[model samples]
Target: MTPPPGWYRDPHAPHLERWWDGTAWTGHRRAPGTPDVPPVPPAGGTGRAKAVALTTAGAVLVAAVVTGAVFLGGDDDEAETKTGPTATTSSSATGLPAPSPSTSEPATGVPDVVEDELNGVTFPLLDGWVRPEHVAQDDVVMTTDGTYDCPGEGSVCRHGLVVSRTVTATDQTSPEALAEEDIPEAAEDAFGEDALGQQPYGGLESHRVVKSGPVAVAGRAGYFVRWRVTTAEGPGGYVQSLVFPSSVGTESPVLVRYVFDAGEDGPPLADMDRITKGIRPVTDADSGGGVGSSIGPAH
Candidate 1:
């Protein structure tokens, strides 16, 4: 594992810092009180680490960013200390910035994750993402990078970000059934009719169903679908769907929908994956119920 790029406590010295150039430990070391000094290798420990890009995104990176972790040996709890440098400086080896790439820039302060429980499932919301003004249902929790332009020929768009998730139990629902009901129908409205089956799911701004495959949702066999739709705000990213069996009394199935817009910087596929994979049903042993009933709509 490539140690994150930062100034961590020099295991050799109590308050001194060693720069982790996102690869191996750099001979570069810095002391506290001084922010502009160069890093030099401390007293001991040879420096060598096979490194990868610092842009790999996920929970591990988030954890490192949150705690401002130091590079002790990977998986080695022997030399860790509770201290770190408190200044802004980049690594001489990797030239990467302090903090980390996974550090979020949400409207609010950065949080490891903003989480909530809905429809008997608990999941994390993106930090700084704002709640949508409207939702399909109260039980549906919707938040976005920012306000979406009003829907119009060209003015309406989900520019940048739109994250919404909801769980609904019908008489019954399945992966294929939800796809049949939601995908083709929605694409038809965005484009003409059968736009999904007629063409690829992405490009052209016209809505389309691009790809699909079998997936496991909440440990149940399910499916996932990706869609591209036209928006006035900007070209939209993919809207994903996950349908699976509800953890309820073993009858009602659940359907969860996701609409993501990562912004001009491109879709935040990593953040989306983190949130999606974090979903879990509250079991009877944990929450005492199957799935919770809808309260109202998002407002």
Candidate 2:
């Protein structure tokens, strides 16, 4: 239930408090222990909650996204019919696409499926993929089997990686809009440069859209934009951004990104289609046994 109007920890700025005026977030903000000021919603009032947050929340989320960026490379796990569950929270906010509140850890024992309760979805682990052992945010990053030294020293990289999270920075719900807006950022995060400023693929140089269109995911109409990116150092890669609405909560927008190294060692691009088809609802995963059902919306 929505809490009564009051100052609460700002999801965008955890160090400060932003007013939650009953039904929506307000522009009024103050530090803890400070005297209260009458709530002053954004100039346009409560209706602008989303617009205000979209404009103001990015400063906080950029750090999270950058920090969570990792150099990609991985091994092989045969596809399995077995299924399991894993939970993760969402990040706070950043530029246009921000993060959300943290959620529970992934349920143990189910390796073939990763459940994101916060976003109300599940991602099937395709052949040669494994769930992440550790991650920086609520991201569910499924990667290929092994790791190799980076083109730059001091780190390892994976050949393929897929990450999913809730887009909490804006009230914008159009999957096509979110997908188009997110592709560049996703490409940069996965290929341009890593958290440490290391360019595992020699830093992204340029990119061209290979595919862009509407697609169904988890039975929800969504959109996807895929690009073939070129880098300065090693073999570049392909990245795609997929945005859809969560099944739970207010049906918030959810973002899923895919990164595949452009080499034979990387996963076959077809796996992208297979895994996308494998996505399902967390409840369905719990009751349906495994990922045999094709529940995602068709492209």
Candidate 3:
């Protein structure tokens, strides 16, 4: 049987040439492998064979023309079929070419920041205070000269101090509720009976609502209360507490304490004030999961 338009049967091979009809397919069929070479006409004979030969030549020419036309038309039709209405519609909708995944570009936009990382928050350390060797991960510890002068040798008499704050994820629970139950527990864990001299500061002192300020660690909210206790040692060391709420019922609230030898000549209280006020929340973009440190002087 003759194949449909745009389709051809290769007589020399067992395979069929499938055709894309712009919208659908045309079935396959067998066809002659080679073009038939027509015989030359006789000079001057109106014989029956000559007449038959002429007719056959004309039919061959017509078939050749038809075949060429069908192939050329099929080429144009196939091109249009590949780039037709559906392709245009998709391109318009997405405002880009259809994605050839192998050749596609990576996605473009701002990257997201995680809230739990604490690396972005920074505090300015007061001048003349030396950072210590045993600093905690999220805490910045420093020391200043106090009533006792720096000793010439081992374990100098200078005041020892630690300052730290962190922001961590929390639930919807109010900072007051979390602090009411959790702060005492955490203080005891970290400071033992030394946690004794707890007092309310900010709005928490009046038994009213505890107010929270912006968190330095992202995705958290709360304020810290300041507590003080004097050590029994002769150097007369002092410890100050700073505690704030974390995500409800989860991670512990951030706790920072400063310990130092008590003295009239120590650094001014203004330094501590500056550090506390400077603390603020940090986003993932700022911390990169705490891999890097934030820029600023130590407080």
Candidate 4:
């Protein structure tokens, strides 16, 4: 008999239950009693899907056109990012021609996909995401759809992505250390020190590491961190980073990351993963160069 729709133990992911979509296994699975974990997307599925996250309140940090410099940090004194939700709206994005092998046939939600030629990375961009006015340095890029006042207690934040083309090193710190400890501390030390440590600017809350564990990015072992941020009263975000495997380079990981801002119109973590998976290294940072190779004085 065809059983009614219900949760059943997943044969693939033994730890979770899989969904039987009447006709076949939908690939939507979860733990037996676990709550809040998002539905597992089916492999080779077709249809336009809005990415969702495990947490109820979460968004991502993105969209841009200008091909600019690549570096992390800025010279300007850190601005005190006000705590709570912002009233910014999604900014219009000037789309770029898809990068090499881009225009991911599978990615649909992002109409204006952006390509970073310098760093050899490309990803989908939300319709109204725009570039941030100022950042710590060129290597770090922050883009977002404006923030807004939410209907409920929290504010809808500017959802976007922050890409750090200049990550210091992968081996200097463990993957867990980089995601859980270093990333937040580094961000705070650079931006949060000013004021409103409780508040967040550019959709970033004084990020708090909520959960972390191992995950794969671009087929590489990595770390993922779910953060409980205070950008809005009830808003939050997540940061997922993967180091280039030792086969690539121990010194640096072509830092692959996703900054999700839990805004009213925020993109879900699952959607973010779809784009991150498309990232393909243009040049092998794994060959010859180890960590911190661009150190010598300019010729």
The per-residue C-alpha lDDT of model 3 at residue 266 equals 48
> Candidate 4: misplaced stretches above 4 Å?
1-113, 126-137, 140-142, 147-157, 169-173, 186-211, 231-236, 240-242, 245-251, 283-299
Per-residue accuracy of model 2 over 20-122 as CA lDDT, tens digit each: 5444444566666566555544454353212111111111122222212442211122110100112111122111222222222234465567666556677
TM-score of candidate 1 versus the correct structure, residues matched by position: 0.42
Taken over the whole model, the C-alpha lDDT of each candidate is 0.37, 0.57, 0.29, 0.37
Assess candidate 2 and give its TM-score to the true structure. Answer: 0.62
The RMSD (Cα, Å) of candidate 4 is 20.3
lDDT of 3 by residue, 1-299 (tens): 11122332211122333221332222222233323222232466311111110011011111111001001111211111110111111211223333211001111232121111222333334566543332211123344533242322112233445444332323423444443433333323222221122211101111121222333323344434333322222322233344444332334455444443334554555554454444444322223213112211222
TM-score of each prediction = 0.42, 0.62, 0.33, 0.42
lDDT of model 4, residue 147: 50
**Which candidate comes out best when scored by TM-score?**
2
At residue 127, candidate 2 shows an lDDT of 78
Candidate with more favorable, higher TM-score: 2 or 3: 2
lDDT, model 3: 0.29
**Residue ranges of candidate 2 with Cα displaced over 4 Å:** 1-111, 134-138, 286-299
For candidate 2, give the lDDT.
Answer: 0.57
Root mean square deviation (Cα) for candidate 1: 20.4
lDDT of 1 by residue, 70-142 (tens): 1212222111111122223333323444432211112124233322222334445555444433221111233
